[model samples]
Every structure is written in structure tokens, then in C-alpha cells.
Target chain A: MADEHVEADNAEAIIARIEHKSRKIESLLKQYRPVEALKTALEGSPPNTRDERCKSANWIMVHRAIMAIKDVDGMFSSLDPEYYDILMKYLYRGLSTGDRPTCDQCLRIHEKLTERAGLGCILRSLSDTVNTV
Target chain B: MAAVEVHRFAQCITCHAWSPDRSMLAFCPNNNEVHIYTLMQSKWEKLHVLQKHDQIISGIDWSARSNKIVTSSHDRNSYVWNLEGSEWVPTLVILRLNRAALCVQWSPKENKFAVGSGAKTVCICYYEQENNWWVSKLIRKRHDSSVTSVAWHPNNILLATASTDGKCRIFSTYIKVVDAKESKTVSSSDAKFGELILQLDLSSSWAFGVRWSPSGNTLAYVGHNSMIYFVDEVGPSPLAQNVAFRDLPLRDVLFLSERLVVGVGFDCNPMVFAADERGIWSFIRFLGERRITSSGPKYGSQLSGAFRTLYGQPKHGLSNDTNDHSRPQGTVHENCINCIVPLGTSGSSKVMRFSTSGLDGKVVVWDLENQADLSEYF
Candidate 1:
């Protein structure tokens, strides 16, 4: 059907967009700019796409960007407060993976982010059921 | 700093209300009876016991003008009490609810009252002189879950409800016979009773408490997720903002003025939030002392503190240690707070004093007149 064709086209376009963003985040990480990589990964995150494939692909890029950062406090200092809620969502997503290193890193960032932002960040991330990572 | 006066009345208090003159207190002591107490020569003396509810009383409110007391209970009923010459007489209300009545409040005019129930409906009750009893009109088929709290607007025609469905809704309760058409200040004068005005879906979790500002221009409510939401311009295009806090979720909220709000719940402390000149609401500070952290003492002192706790001398010897964590020390209320009521004249816009009751069965009055830090808020 024509509807099926449109759906397929949309999914393909989202996948291509994810790949392009991942490459840009990777190049930023390569240049030893983890903060920029993080900002890039978090931009337009929890993307408007409902496709599981697109979401997983975007998460992989975000996880890579988060893990690349060496100085957590230094990176958080320069980060904007507007990204706090989005970053918190991704950190929760990272913890859900059950991967040991990913959870450890996410917890470290979560602790610092909570200290910086206060309790509202956690409540927003958990209660905002519409915007899942 | 605010002056605090603590009164321990029971082992647990479900809800409380103050008499019109502020000389007596009526509170449900986590049971079926309502206890009235008065301060006599610096001691709280039990004045009367009104035992009528078959189950635990859930809500209580004393009308400042009419000097009547209304109470709802888990027994699926409500009653209006009249003080007749030293004896309190109870008149049963026709709520007709199949489930428990969770909360109740009198409208500003004291001619009617609204009750929230587990039946997922709000019963707006008014006195019927012909029938010689109270009657209720139900607002049904709107709430998806149990209604948690109900607040009447200052206009006496608009009612706001908080529900477990994570929605705060406004409805016009303008009864034709009871409310004057010109008194519909917030909505159109011709708006019918039980008309839904607005529904806010800002909270994703159960919303607990809802309150209206003194001028009835703003609405504030708290969620189970430790977030407090403020809604302004309450019409078709109302603006709402949610401010999340780090402490435990609040069970109830009270507006001290147009811009100042105090919330109390699982934190066992009343946290104050105020709006700035731009009307952006933010956490100001804890009206109670800040919570003490456990990282204060070294390891050796911690061991000594533990020993003191084990030897039953924790209060005297290890008063500074965090070992006795079961009960929060230094705070007046030792358990989750359940309700807060203003302590000044009922219709005042700026309240200088308020009282809070908690699950620990303590009622503490906070006087804010001399609080230097809070002067700016007024």
C-alpha cells in the first residue's frame, strides 16, 4: 500500500539521520572534544522517531560520547542547564542497558548532575513518561 | 527566623482544623473520633470528644464566619457539626457515595462545601432549608481516578480538584439557587454548575494537594514525584510551570500570599517556594532547619556515636551523630506532615502565622511576623 511505502521511507530517513549524527559525534570525540561530542549527541535527542532501531542507534552514539569524556566535572561546568533534563534521560537509558561500565559511568555523571541541578532533574526525568530516550 | 510552637496531641493525626477564634483545635487522632482541645493556663486541655464516624475521619474544616465544622470519613459519609450551647450536634449529610470520602472543604461563602471521594466524583453539597438537611450534587464522569483534594476559589463558584490520575481540573460549581450570578468572577456569569473549565495534564504522577491563591488568580498543586506546579491565568489558555525539588514529595500545600507557598509531606519539613517579579516560582528554603548530613564526624567519633546509641544515651551523648537516623532530630514533626492551615484571620491576603499537623501526631504553629529572611517575601 502507499501508506506502507511512506512509513518505510520515513524509517529509512531517520536511520540515515542517526548515522550522520553519529559520525559527527565520533569525529568530535576524535578531536578530544568530549563536551562538544556530548552536546551534539544530546541535540534533538529522544528523537521524534518512534522506531526502535533509530532510538537504539542514537543511544549507542550518546553512550560513546559520554564514555569518551575524561574530566566529568570540567565537562559539566561548561554544559548548559537547558541540557540537564535531556542528559538525565540519556543517563537513565545508559543504566537500563545493564552494562557494568555504562552504569558506573552514568551513576558518576548522575551524581554530579544531581548535585548541580538539585532534585528537580531526577523527578523530571522519571515522571516525564512521554519523552523516553 | 520563624517562631515554632509544638503540641503533641496523639500518636498519629490524620487531619486537623482550628476554631474560628483560634482558641480551640479539632483534630482526628488517626481514629473515628474528633478531639477538641483548648489551651488552659499554658496546658492543652481536652474539651470535647465527638465520636460519630464508623471509620477513620479523613478531613476536617471549620468555617470562620458560620462557626460550623464539617468532617468526612472513610465510612462513606460526612457530617456537619453545630455547637449547641456547649454540646456539639451532628447533622448527617446526604453524600450518597459508595466509597470513602477522602477530603472536604467549605466554600468561601460558607453556604456550600465540596467533598472528594474514592468513587471518582466530587459532591458539592449545600443546605436545603425545605428538607431540613444537607444535599449534594455530584460532579461525575470526569475524574479517571480517586480525587485526592478539593479547593474552592475565592469567588465561591469555581472549584479545583487534584486527582490520582495526574490531572488537576477546574470546574464551575455555580448552583442556581445558592450562588448569585454576579459572584461568578472567574468564569462567565451564565456558566452552569459542574461545567468543566480547564484540565491541566502537567503532572505525570499522582497529584496530591491543590490550593488557590488569595485573589483566586493562581492555582498550585503538588505531585507524588516531588514536583510542585503553579498554574496562572486559569482559563482556556492557562500557563503552568512545574518546579521539582530534591526532598521527598509533598502531601499538601498552602498559599501564604499571592506569591508565597509552603508545602509539607514526607520530608517532615515545610519547604517554602516563592515567585519572583517575573512570576517564576523557585524553592526559597526549608522553613524548618536544614537536614543534617552523615559526613560530619570522623570514623572514631562515628564508632563512639554508635556505642552511645546502643547504650541508650544517644540523645545526650551522640546528639550530633547521624547514627540515630530512625527519627529525624531537631525537627518539630517526627513523621510525614499531612495538613497545613493558616493561623490568622480567614480572609486575609497575607498570613503571618500557620499551623501544620503530621503523622507523628504533633501540631506545630509557625509565626512568620519576625522572620527577617521571610520579610522580603511579604
Candidate 2:
């Protein structure tokens, strides 16, 4: 019985560690700067080559970070208000500039931000657009 | 090539092909009763309805792979009936619905199914090992208002949905796997689909049904303008093509083949408008069936051709007739062409036509071969 409890505790510890790491990765991705992380995914990680695999592992680390946000963030609201501030900033940037990037590019930035900033009010606003709320 | 004029025949107000291999036809004369006729032992045999639905059966789908027929009602539940022990048994009842159901369809492979109601969600039911269907995944809060119809992609990996809110959504079934994991915490299942995917704006016009082609290359939708729109993945985005009836409007549209499309509307004078050499929608005058769709009234070519000659109306009725013979040439029954199916390859083979119901609420089978009456039901 004690051993089983210990096993459960270890599992909890692993999950907590993953969550902590996810937080760090979420903060980095929220920057959505596309400088360090995306570069690592494209260049650092070549799944085929040994050298590439090491780099690719780094890229996967970032993906794991993003995928982790997907798992833990579901407990509360899908939209995090803290994330909304970042989204609005991006939306504001796009509207202000005639030079707009592709929506797909915008989506990556938005998703990363959504992961970092869980904004309740802004999520509600966005959700209301489709009468889905 | 072979044309038969329909004479006295029972026009099916509604019909469902029970099994795909040997499709059985069922028609509802009233709200609760179903008249069944099957082709068994190489002959047509009318089967007695073993059961009854207390309310109106708005939509019916027969599993083409199995002897199962699914029927939906306004009472907010869908019943799956299976042929067992020489009798139909209620195998499954999906009662999770809190609203009225509009349509039900079985997946092409027969393993999964979709149900849509006035509710904002659509439940994709997967048959479990216990022989019961479970709400495996829910595409929750899908519509602004109500979802009228849902269709599974032929591959079953994608879902196409239409709603009364005038928006159609295409969702990847992959997201359900994501949401299913979250369902462990029921209180927090805001649903990954809660996020916007692809949204089609139909203005205030309600989108009633959506279907993807068997090849998954094209999508066709039926909307309020009595309209049909086709979209294919090309160029940078999907291009919408307007096919069939520029003005007359349509009740529904079905894709039977790549080039052949079928459409029917609330208008009584049911017309099949096949595209001409230029692929422009052209109305068929029902100058008699080129063949028979089933066994039905033979609307003889003599009357139709005579009617055409006496009126000297154009075969392709495209515009208003200021000519003297153009006056009503005569009014055909508006409700008679309730449901139509093209018999041959393109689904527009013009060989024989099958109809559901309109006037008498009977399953009328037409034999377009002899241009004479074939069979009728009370």
C-alpha cells in the first residue's frame, strides 16, 4: 500500500515538473518572436541526421511545451484573459499596419499567446462572436 | 435512351433505400406510419410495418450495409431498429437530445453516425463493443442557433455541418480526440471546437444540409435562397460554384455523381434540370421518363408531347412565354415531385426516376419503360 502511494506521488511529481516546464515554454512561445524557437525547429532539429536529431529534440521540446499547455489549460476556461492582452496587441498591430501577415502566420502567434495568457474576458468576447457561448 | 411516360402510379411522398446491396423502399403515408416494400426472392414484397413511431418521423436513414433503419422524431430521440428473429427490434435509443431533431444519417462504413437537432451541438455516436452506441464525442456549442443537418465525410475523418444560423462549419474529427481527453473533467469541457475553424457566411439564409463528395474533393451545401453552392479546394481558397436553378430556388440538393447533381424544391411542378452540352442547368420537361425510376404511374409521352405541341412551348423552359400557347400549358402537381433520384450512372442517367411523396402521401413507384401505370399504394 505504501509503495502504491509512493508510485502515485512520483507520478504527481512528474506531472508537476511537466507543468512547471510548460510554464517556462509557454512564456517563451508567447513572445511569438519566431526568432529562437522556430529557427531551432527548422534548422536545429533534423530528425534524420544525428546532429539534426539533437537539434530536432530541441524543437520537439518547444512543441511539447505547446502541447502541454493544451492538456493542463482545459481545466478552467479555454480562453485565458492574460492571453487576450497579447492577442489584442497583435490584432491592434495588424489593424494599424497595411502590411499584414498571412492569417496562418497570425494563427501560430495567436495560439502561442493563447497558451501563455489565459484571458477569461477576452476569450468570452471571442466566443460570443459565433453565438457559440 | 429508353423513355417511358408515367401513367396512373403511386408517387412516393417519401422513400428510403433500406439496404444498399438490396435496397428496400419505405414510405410514410402519414406522420407515424411507414409502408414498406422490399425486393426479396427476386420479387417485390410489401412488408408489414412491425412497429410504429408515436410522433412524426421527420428523417429516416437505412443502413445500406446492414438491416438497420434509423428514424428521428420531434420528441428528441433517434431509434435504431434492426432486423432480428424475423422482426425489427429497437437496438439503440439516443436520448441525450434536449431539443428537436431535424436529420440523421449513417456513415458510409456503417460504424459511426451523426445526429443533429435544433440544439447547438451534434453528437457523433460510435458503436461500442457492448452493442450500444455511446456519445463518443460531442461537437459542443457548434452553432449560433440550431444545427439542421450533419454529414460525415466519406472517409469519416471529417464532419460537415449546417445550421439555421446561416453558417456552415467544417471540423476535423481529430479535434474530438482532443476534446474527449478533456471530457474527464466534465465541468471544464469548453470543447476545443469552441475555437473557430472554417466558417461559411450564408447571410440570413439558413443552411439546411451539407455534404462532401465521395472523393472528398468537393463540398455542396443547400441554403435558404432555394439555392445550392459547390466549393472545391483550388487556387488559394475554396471557390464557390452556383449550380442548378438560378431563379426557381430549390428545397434540397444531393450529389449522386461527379458531373450529375439532383435538386428538388417546394414547388409542385417537380422538374429535373440536367445541364446541357455547355453544362448549363436546363430543365427536363418530364416529356415522359426516358426509363423507369421504379414502378410508378406512366405519365405518357402522348399527353406530355401533345401538351408541348398544343402549347408549342420551348422544350427547355428558361424564360417567360409571351406566346399564346405558353399560358400555363397546364399546371402540373406541385407536390408530386417530393423526392427524386437519378437511376443511372451519373445519377442523372434519365433512364428511370424514383420519387418519394407529395399529394397522396403514398409510395408511388414508376416504371418508365412502357410509359404506363406500374404500381400504387393506398
Predicted structure with the largest lDDT when compared to the true one: 1
Q: What class would a CAPRI assessor give candidate 1's docking?
A: acceptable
Interface RMSD computed for candidate 1 is what?
7.1
**Model 1: CA > 4 A from native:** A1-16, A49-51, B180-187, B291-330
DockQ of each: 0.28, 0.01
* Cα lDDT tens digits for candidate 2, B1-378: 122222222433443443544356665554655556676786667785735567656567777657577876667777777777877776546657787766777776666667777778776666565654545356777688788777766555456788878777876554354336434544223424334446777434667657665466667776655456666662237666654332233445555444334454443334343434544443343322332222332234323432443343533353234242322323233233344433332323233444434443433333344433221100
> Interface Cα RMSD for all candidates?
7.1, 23.1
Model 2, global lDDT: 0.49
Whole-model lDDT, model 1: 0.85
Cα RMSD (Å) per model?
Answer: 4.8, 20.9
What TM-score does each of the candidates earn? 0.88, 0.53
Q: Which stretches of candidate 2 lie over 4 Å from their true place?
A: A1-133, B1-15, B39-45, B50-52, B131-136, B174-197, B234-236, B243-248, B269-333, B336-355, B359-378
For model 2, give the interface RMSD: 23.1
